[model samples]
Target chain A: MWPGPADPVQDLIDNFADLDSLVRVYPLLLQGFGLTILLSIVTLPIATASGLAVAVAYSTAGTGVRRMLVVAIDILRAFPVLVLLVLIFYGLPFLGLRLNAFAAAVLAIALNNTGYFGEIFRAGIEAVPPGQGEAAAALGLHRMRVLIHVILPQAIRKVTAPLASNALELVKTTSIASLVSLPELLRSARVAQEQTYNPTPLVAASLLFFALLWPFARWVARLERRALATGH
Target chain B: MDRIAENYFNGAVIAAALPAVLRGFGITVLVSLSTIVVGISAGLGLALLRCAAIRPLDIAIAIYVDLFRTLPQLVILVFLYFGMPYLGVTLSPFVTVVLGLGAVLAAFSAEIIWSAILALPPGQWDAARALGLRPVPLLFLVVLPQAVRLATPLITNRAIAITKGTALGTAVSLPETLGSAQSAMAIMANPSPLTLAAALYLLFFIPLVALSRVLERRVARAG
Candidate 1:
């Protein structure tokens, strides 16, 4: 009887005019947002460190090891992040290793991000010239010293923008954890929507996500533009 | 060994679930192809509009591109599928996935195509104008072919990445590859269906990934 599609304008207003519900769901959404941020915060460092290690190993490994590593990274990259999550969460129990939802999500996403970041790091490393390494060796610097002093600094500089972009992507991906029943932003939004039979919570969640991610997205865009301007 | 086989790698479970998974694969391919086609066509149109340099229209297109590009794909999918019914509009799951993914694909494609157009040497435009070609015909006849060629490798790569997003349809219960596998696994109580699903995904995407790689190398060499 009330705004049942007959009055389209009124219908639109009624759908979104629920400030009380919006305010009610705010704390729950914020809590979920906090967890999303924490997930990314925990993931970034682990992914970066492991990615660097994998890149370094790839560079120095023998042919067999290099081949194996390349194949593994390829498979990881090829699988969708969601599929990887499902595989790790569901498949691991069969192997007699069970993980809580949070742990499983972190492990799966971090592993996937490692593949991407390792590739970026390798490209950055390869972008450095062979002449620089040889010149350092000629100067009697030990191999490790040469790497730390001459190589890694430049490689890190080259890869920073890409690494930042990957971090942002990791942030967005943390939402997938909700599918495994983690009460992250998306799941919280779903819960609110079901509870109130209103979509305002979903809209609020989207706005929160945009607020959280838009600045990073713009920053990454600026970094890319600056890199391009510098002819990198 | 038998217990391990029964729980994780049960052959009977895989054989039972293979047909449903295959059907889901068909749906995945169809949805992906439909999205790609719609996305590319819409993207080309947007690129054309942007190239015309109409101020207000360009601003609107820019906003559309940025919004789709910045937001998570799942957010859009959930909003369209789950949130729209509240507003008195209902979209089937298939249409929802297509529209959601198509919009994203359009944003990327528009950027790529627009850049390709910009990268064309200015002299080509001048030359065509000197030959008495109007802007519309010149853009369609002289410029689009070369721009599309330049954009092909990038477009293909983006297509592969976005097409993988078809799996996100599973979130809406679309019964695509991942969804069918999840349901099958739930029914059989064995994880082998998931193993099968993973293999099917690999079988479907690995070739496209490799092809994109080759296309990238070819484009680089051509440049």
Candidate 2:
């Protein structure tokens, strides 16, 4: 006998056979994916630049300032990015400064990421030999020039693996923007699933995410292995 | 200022929402602890399998870890919560979140433990083999103890990060800390509940962050 409607296998086939359903939702999901990519692209440079500034300040500051900066970074690291997003998106309006959902999400994610990137950059900077800076200075190079020519390039290379991994994380994290009603990939899939009463769109979205992120993940893993092998 | 305080920082609103948020926090703790247990055990099992170096299983696990590692936890949760019903495997929201997050934690922990195992000097393995110890006993007795020590700091840090992910349960309407606070905010039309939730999050996570630091320092000193 052919499988009937009550058969679980039949139901599963029916559930997944909704290719038309998936096709309908594809554009929405694509737009959402575009937004996710955009958010990540925008967030990375901002977070990294601010993080570099913080790391530099922390390294060069007086002991009192360094202590305070350390505390601030620790607090920011401890704070959940979701809570940060919520506080900024929902709570900041209380302070008479309202931001749209996109702006709020970007600000919160960037702030949280800056804390992580700052710590990473600081470690990278420390990994460079202090002698390099002194040697450059002794060569009659200005302090700023020494930092620019001798320190940052090495530090950036050292931190590339962590930074790339963080960037991938930020990409995945764009899903969280759905909570604030930003029409990112997850939100689009959810909307489609609700409208169609089928899970095919969600599956499509998962595949889309995997397709987008897998290569980058592999690249980061490769970089990390190389870095580790080089004793960096 | 008075109007601002009345609308956004109302003490009464926060007080009224405190119980709900605390209840949600209790759920968060429960979910995190339970997932930690599941994740670490699964991770240990996977690491042992990986140590055996069977080509097929290793490849399978590598794929599994890669999939979980790269995919967003939110997507996984959505799939399990919404997609599984088609397969005739419906789970409660709590189970869905736990399973989703636990899978991620397991992948990370497995990697940490496997690397720790690799970092063990080759002599240790050879010495155990010479002692006429079989693979199972040798692994259980010699390698794992040292690997566990090496893996502890990283495992703890990863565990805290994953536990913080319990907040994402809100996306699935799990009524965890963030979810409950969101509902309270909706009902009260004030952000006081969210503020309270933020304070609670800080209170909970700050200590864990501090502890992770201490552990990291100790590990560095030991090395």
Best candidate, TM-score: 2
As a whole number from 0 to 100, the lDDT of residue A201 in candidate 2 is 83
User: In model 1, what are the clashing residue pairs, if there are any?
Assistant: none
Query: Best candidate, lDDT-wise?
Result: 2
Alpha-carbon runs more than 4 Å astray in model 1 = A1-6, A156-162, A223-232, B1-3, B119-132, B216-223
Question: What TM-score would chain A of each candidate receive against the reference chain A?
Answer: 0.92, 0.94
TM-score of chain A of 2: 0.94
Put down candidate 1 lDDT per residue, A134-209, tens digits, no spaces. 9999999998888889888888797776678778778888888988988989989999888778888888888889
Worst 10 residues of 2 chain B by lDDT: B214-223
Model 2, CA-based lDDT: 0.85
- The docking category that best describes candidate 1 is medium
- List model 2 lDDT by residue over B113-214, tens digit each: 887787788999999999999999999999999989988887898788888889999887898989899899989988889878888888888899889878
Model 1 Cα lDDT, one tens digit per residue, B102-144: 9988987887788778777789999999999998899999999
True contacts kept of each: 0.49, 0.65
Q: What is the lDDT of residue B197 in candidate 1?
A: 84
